[model samples]
Target: MRVAAFLCEALTRGTTHAEPLAVEGNRLDFVDTLRQLQPDLVINLCESLAADSRGEILIPGLLDLLGLPYTGSSALSLGLALHKPKAKELLRARGISTPAFAVVQRPEDVKAVDLPYPLIVKPAHEDASMGVDFDSVVHTPAELARAAIAVLSTFHQPALVEQFIQGREIYVPLLGNAPRRALPLTEIHFGQAFENRPNIVSYKAKWETESPECRDSTSALCRLEDTALEERLIQTAVGAFSALDCQDYGRVDLRVSAEGVPYVIDINPNCDLHPGAGFAKAAAAAGIDYPALANRLVEIALERTHGNPSHRTKGPGTARRVDPPNRNVLAGRGPVRHRAGGPRAHAE
Candidate 1:
């Protein structure tokens, strides 16, 4: 079936604009472009785009208006997942284990917060380790404040200060919904460099593909021997994914402590799905090849669309939809409210 791949110009910049590519320089045009193509399905790989432009909102709304099926989580899930603080708060309330964190909008905000040192600081809304690096680990309150200010000034957003979990970095890829399948567990091997720098996936390690410091710092390795441990990891990964209402496929990053206790570090809804990316690698380990995996996602989207009859329409209408409020507004003020029988007591 034909698929419309919607990606932001920020991601496509400096890249070749070849066929099968519809580049929307501004995210506002995403819906209009999708309307023009009217493909059978839409693969939303547009994480780098601005959230306020309602880039997240427009996707699902467009699909609903046009009665088209699409891959990945719905717009509500996308908005919740994009806001780190809100996601963490929701997860915490659900009793899903996550790193303890404090949101910092300004340098002075760090003063009242009470998280431990060697704290990790990052842009609250950014993913793919945008402002995270070795310097993100701060030991002193002053250093933490400085890092928070730097991230806010650079990314123009609030900073998330979280307790740094020191242990093995593990990633579990989850697919399907009714009976979610967690692929093989992938570990980040720091190797000898851990002696010098202590293993952590910094921003440079992720974005700078050719940086020697990163090259020497990290590696993704799978194939674990312990069946019981693997089972536990998979269960925890699935729990976290479901807790966040993530759909289709996604990856959950966790850190296992010395006692084998896993803490959810991050839940990625629209993770990198390139054939060479971690998600694909993990799927391959689970016996789902790249093309098969992609097709499976399409099938899942169609199933969801068919089940939700009210969500379908013949074509895009002129109905205008308003954007939802920023998640920060809710999370920044106080503790988030949860429905009854919240957070399940899962391992991670």
Candidate 2:
């Protein structure tokens, strides 16, 4: 909410007011609210609808039906992105590197897996590390079956089993269109909380504020001196972004293999935008202040809007070749924040 206020104020130049519209569950009410408010533009910070992650893929379709211009990716891209395996297929089709993997809706389905061991399994249709935990990183067929079964039963979705890339977990956020700019790269550093455990961001590490995994995990400005490697990382993420036809702003997550090859691990459209999160941190590292980022993204979307009022922006990712700028580096410890009192709820 505070972040919204900053954006509202920043965009208020030459305007009356800008605000956020909160939609809980009532679909009609949301549509009616939009009809009434008739917002000039929408930032599309919605992460989900009615507490369901998949529901997020529908919001843009609604906005488009009402002929509204908005920030972020289109509904089609969102659909491909939410389904992890589908996004990987698109990436591979583009000749981009992603982990080798398979899907399983039933325990026995794991038998068809030809990939090597030490695979990570998670709910195929979910995001935000929702069905992932210590057991997600499995090494044996029995463990793989248990993990796949857990996802099938708990999340009621097919399980995605991919070869686990053991190395650095990096996030690349790209903003704008025609020339999408990749922000400073950010890396997740695992602390003692992950000792002897896989360096994956489990459900607890991400959302359970009180958990040790959350406590010890930190997001820091990735300091890679190898200009060539950095370029590869950014271009790989950009490749994934374009393959999905994502627009405005989005993030691509990758895990560098032990052999130093960066592989796309996740494509997060409409990724977290809280000031304390990775996207905002990368923006800040790029010398883009919070309000500036808020304002700039609006301009990006508005540019696409005025350029073609009727046509939805869709094309191969237009990447601007940008060189990295010096960063604050989160003072070396990384920009780590936590919800102090209790666990942050994972759902609506």
Candidate 3:
């Protein structure tokens, strides 16, 4: 079956050099291109969309409009996962352990939310460590406020002020259902001096590939952990996944406190799938190579489409059922409403 990958042009740039047949474009162009191709499956790897600009939900809605079968979580799930504060609230409400966080729209808003310091400030709506830096960990409320404002102004979004958990940073990759398999846990090990600074996967640490802070400080060390603790991490990660309603494949980032309790920092529904990325690395650890992983995602999408291809096969006279208005023709004003035991008349 023919497969089309929908990803941002920026991500697809280097990819074409290795895979000459890969089609790449910006989000809108990519959607149009995919429509023209009409491929059996579309792998959506585009991180952010224009609708995400103002926090408007777009991903799943667009896919529905396109009537295309695509891999990963639906638009509702993606939108929910993208907003960190909302995601955390949902997880917390569901009895899942997550880092305590406060949302800050302005610098002054920081004082109202009394979270402990050495707090971490990050763009509330961004992922991939965007707008996070070494200075994101603030030891004082004033500094926290300043960092929050900087993030809000720079990223044009609210700031997530969270209590920084200093401990082992672990990422749990998950795949499939009925019995979801958690791949080997990957840890971020920072050297001694950097220990004072909370083990943060900051924006600089993530994006600035050539920065000295990264070169001199952190390392992504996999295959290093005790068996019992590793099992706990996987269990907690799975709990977070179920709590968030994440589907297909994704990754959950966590920090194990000194006491060994795993606190979820983030749940990524549409994580990076590049061969060099963390998700792919974890899949490799589970003995599923890059191509096999990609194909599995496609398989999941096809399964979903098989159940509901109405969106894909839409045509004239294909209109589905709709509930009629709540009014009785005989009454002319309103319909009789039922309240458990009896029917009652309601005015228009």
Candidate 2 segments whose C-alpha is farther than 4 A from its true place: 1-6, 13-16, 308-348
Question: Which candidate number would show the highest lDDT if scored against the true structure?
Answer: 2
Cα lDDT of model 3 by residue, 304-325, tens digit: 5554332344344433222133
Error of model 2, residue 207, in angstroms: 1.3
TM-score of 2: 0.86
After TM-score superposition, the amount by which residue 257's alpha carbon in candidate 1 deviates from its true location, in angstroms, is 1.2
Across 316-346, the per-residue lDDT of candidate 2 in tens digits comes to 4433112133210000001112323332221
The 0-to-1 C-alpha lDDT of every candidate, in the order given, reads 0.64, 0.76, 0.63
Ranking 1 against 2 by lDDT, winner? 2
Q: Which order, best to worst by lDDT? A: 2, 1, 3
Put down candidate 1 lDDT per residue, 1-348, tens digits, no spaces. Answer: 012222221112232121233324443554565567555555555443333323554556556677656678877777777788998888888777788999998778988889766688888886666677778888898888889999989888899999988887888888877667777777776655445564677655665556544556444555667677677777777877887788988888888877777788888886666565677777777788866676567556655655522234424452322212220000000111111221111101
Per-candidate alpha-carbon RMSD to the true structure: 11.2, 8.6, 15.6
Which residue window of length 10 is worst by lDDT in model 3? 327-336
Superposition TM-score, candidate 1 onto the true structure: 0.78
CA shift at 116, candidate 2, in angstroms? 0.4
The list of candidate 3 runs beyond 4 A from truth reads 1-33, 50-57, 192-195, 216-226, 307-348
Positional deviation of residue 111's Cα in model 3 after best superposition, in angstroms: 1.7
